[model samples]
Target: MNANLKGAAMMVAAMAGFAVEDMLLKSAARDVPVGLILMIFGALGTVWFAALAKSRGDRLLNRDLLHPVVGAKSLAEIVGRLFFVLALALAPLSTVSALLQATPLVVVAGAALFFGERVGWRRWSAIAIGFAGVLIVLRPGVDLGWGSVAALLGMLGFALRDLATRGAPKSLSNMVLGVYGFLALVPAGAIMLAVTGGAGVPPAAALGLIATASVVGTGAYYALTSAMRLGEVAVVTPFRYTRLVFALILAALVFGERPDLLTLLGSAVIVGSGVYTLLRSRRETQTAAAQEI
Candidate 1:
């Protein structure tokens, strides 16, 4: 397969990892502090990503992960992961997944600001309507709650994380970047553990399941970044909706959580809008490439 297709495949795998990780975290949240669970995920991320780097022949001996730009990107990711975990912990998986559907919009805005990328009227329109879909999912003022707030903040934070990762040096692989991201979280996790009266060990079975989730997540980060880079950000992003399908199914199976009609309808709108944006972006990228040729 071509490199780009390989990247998309990796990204799809990453999304699957993300789905499983979210499920595990949501479940573990019931028995453990949110802080502790996230911290554990970070720890797992650090070790697994570092190993991936070494195995891939990416050196891990850099004084820093290649300047402040990469460092900033990794740190942003740490913050994003923390917020995402808390969001999932406190809210329904379907809702958090749906809220995260807003990510493509965030990416478009970030590209315009950071990379001097241009946004045509078409993309801008899709973004606006896509956010409207988010509002539909949120229906914020009507059903105001902490989970909504957490999901919103988490969405924004992850957006930043994604943006920062874009400018990282080509020398560093995703594995290296992921390693630093998790390492950045270590101190933060330790601090939280202290604040939470030390880690409260949950059932061994739960802990094991969570550990597996963390491992998949560590690998998934690389897949996701690869996907974003391989395809047009706008185009490849709609594939993220696949997570919602997994989440909804798991939510029903694991939690017996049934979403109401409004939720499903809103999610459909949000996802459909996102898919349109992705297709447009992909077409645009192709047109741009053809022009260059």
Candidate 2:
């Protein structure tokens, strides 16, 4: 298979793995506290990523890990993981996943605002439409809930994380970055556990679920990294949307979730806007390259 095909396959596989991880975590959350689930999952992921980094001869304690950009990334990771897991446990999986589809759109707007990247009016309009879709999903005056708010905050946190990642040092390997990302979950979980007082001895079934989720989540991250490396980014990145498809399916099968029509419509709008933005960006990049030539 060609690079793009392989990358697309990897991306799909990664999405499937992530959907499964989310399912498992949600299941475990029934028996285990959300904070405890995060602690165990984060601990396992930290070990897994650290081992991968060691195998690659990457230093786990590099000074670059202390860089301001990395600090920002860590903060964002904490917020993202904490709220996202909360949403998974509290909300319908389909709705949380659908809201997550807005993350890349947020990242695009952030890039233009913070990185000084020039975004044309068309892309900005797409971003606006994407956010409107979020409101549709939220339906502010009608039926907004804490679950929806948590998912929205989680999406914003993740977008900020992606933005901070852009400023991270090139010297940090993906594995090392993964280590820090997972490591941040420890404090995030601890803080929440303290506030909620949900700490308890998790049952064997919960342990099993958490372990399986950690393994699947780690593998998904690796596959995502490989996909990005293996293909033209513009070609591979759009496949990230497949996660929502997988999540929707899993939500129906595992949780018996039946998303409302507005949720579906909003998800469609978010995905369409994101795709348009990506394609527009690709076109502009090509135009710039042609001009340079």
Which segments of candidate 2 are over 4 A away from where they belong?
Answer: none
Candidate 1 lDDT by residue in tens digits, 198-227: 476678877887798877777677678778
Error of 1 at 268 (Å): 1.9
Backbone clash total for model 2 is 0
Residue 137 of candidate 1: its Cα lDDT? Answer: 80
Compared with the true structure, what per-residue lDDT tens digits does model 2 show for residues 193-275? 99889788899988998999999998998899999989988899889999999999999999999999999999999999999
The best candidate by TM-score is 2
Error of 1 at 125 (Å): 0.7
Off by over 4 Å in 1: 1-13, 63-66, 196-198, 222-237
Candidate 2 Cα lDDT to native: 0.91
Each model's lDDT comes to 0.78, 0.91
Model 1: residue 5 alpha-carbon error in angstroms = 8.2
Q: Output the worst ten-in-a-row residue range by lDDT, candidate 2.
A: 29-38
Q: Which is the leading candidate under lDDT?
A: 2
